[model samples]
Target: MSLSTKSPKTSPIKIMQNRIYELLKQGKRIDGRAPHEVRPVSISTSVIEKADGSAMVSMGGTKILTGIKVETGTPYSDRPNEGVFTVNAELLPLASASFEPGPPDERAVELARIVDRCIRESRAIDLEKLVITEGEKVYMLYIDIYVLDYDGNYFDPAVLSAVAALATCKIPRYEMRNGKLERVEGESMKTPIRTIPVSVMIGVIQDRLLVDPSPMEERALDTSVILGYDSDSNIVSIQKNTPGLLSLNMMEQIIELGSKKAEELRSILVEAVGLGS
Candidate 1:
């Protein structure tokens, strides 16, 4: 008697995902990088000529552009002494097949809010210096982030671009003319910055961690965490995306790795801002 056996067929998506996860378990990756290594990142300032300040950061296949447009605006009643800072993130359809044409969904909103808080809470820029007429009007810093690709890990690069853009940005110098703000011709000044906050994201699947996972790896991961570190080596912001329960040990491990990455990224930001690497 003869017996016939057949192997079950697997979908390409499932096979691809399995291949990625299998490599993770073996301390290997599709790109042949170290388990905790990040993709090569390059940054340049002033990509958008019309924007007062702009920067583009490319990490592997992922790319994000941040543009800053500072203008005179009214201060909020609750914080009349502070200038308004806003971050808007756009996941354009052209960037990826998943991003649709419509209002920003929860993902977009969350991305913007996280980056906004990082800059605001970290005191990256001295908002008080933006005041022109005190409670009447102040220079509002509007940061718009454009996602040009969706390989993975957009948050860290977006925040980096925003900071770089702001650091190199030029705001029009205005003086009170007839008790009204008047722009001074042929004069512009750099944004008053206090510190640069570096944000880093890590992908975790079980006890395994990847510093900057590719899109496929990110999709297969169970959890991810974002950490924002200030110049003082203090944690400024933390955002977690967990699909399953993460233990305290896992959180600490993530923190320890993230802190080191933050310091490295901050030096890159400082150099990009013309301070030094």
Candidate 2:
């Protein structure tokens, strides 16, 4: 007599995961984008008149607004000759159902830190040029980011908005008179920009990688990574989310893909801000 064997039944979740993987294998995503394709990006500068500089970035369904305020303050004790720079992010409750109205949770904090790292590590801003009186006084830049909509990949748009805002920032000139500093009316100078930093988010599912994953894609992803690169194609920052492990070969592939994407994003930023390449 021969024993009959039956295959184990596949769980619904597993079936769904398999479907996603299959689609990716065919070079297609649920949203009809290719594995390496990103969503359409739109950028608008000078959105907020009151702020020194401002920009709004929309990537697919995700929207982010960044505003910059410049003020004069004493330089840090250790870095007396350099100016101050701070980045803050807020995920409004209206942006997503998961967001709550209160102080920034871990997600918001992480978002701010990621953007800060990209700018700081890349040295995008010429901080020394912001110094007003060397160690005595210096320009303090406050970059505030707000999530107007949350679809999935907000990291790229947040960085784009912040960088665009900074690129268009106009700081009022100050002159020292009678042992006090006074702003020169009708006189302002553009923020000194050294380089532009662009960030790209990639999601890994099974053996395929997706660029600018949507909310559904994010939920199905095994892991995700964000890579920031300067205009010179040098990596400035890296952030990995989720617990999935990536092989050395996969990591190298990600870097190569990210560098090319970063260049494309940088060109968009430059054109949006009316800057020369």
Q: What digit string (tens of lDDT, one per residue) describes model 1 on residues 6-92?
A: 112212256656777788889888779878787777889998999999999987778999999988888998878888889999987
lDDT score of model 2?
A: 0.88
- Candidate with top TM-score is 2
Residue 127 miss distance in model 2 (angstroms) = 0.4
Q: What is the lDDT of residue 197 in candidate 2?
A: 95
Error of 1 at 216 (Å): 0.5
- Ten contiguous residues minimizing lDDT sum, candidate 1: 1-10
Pairs that clash in candidate 2: none
- Model 2 lDDT tens row, 100-149: 89999998999999999999999999999989888898999999999998
RMSD of each: 6.3, 7.3
**lDDT of candidates 1 onward, in order:** 0.82, 0.88
After superposition, candidate 2 runs with Cα above 4 Å error: 1-15
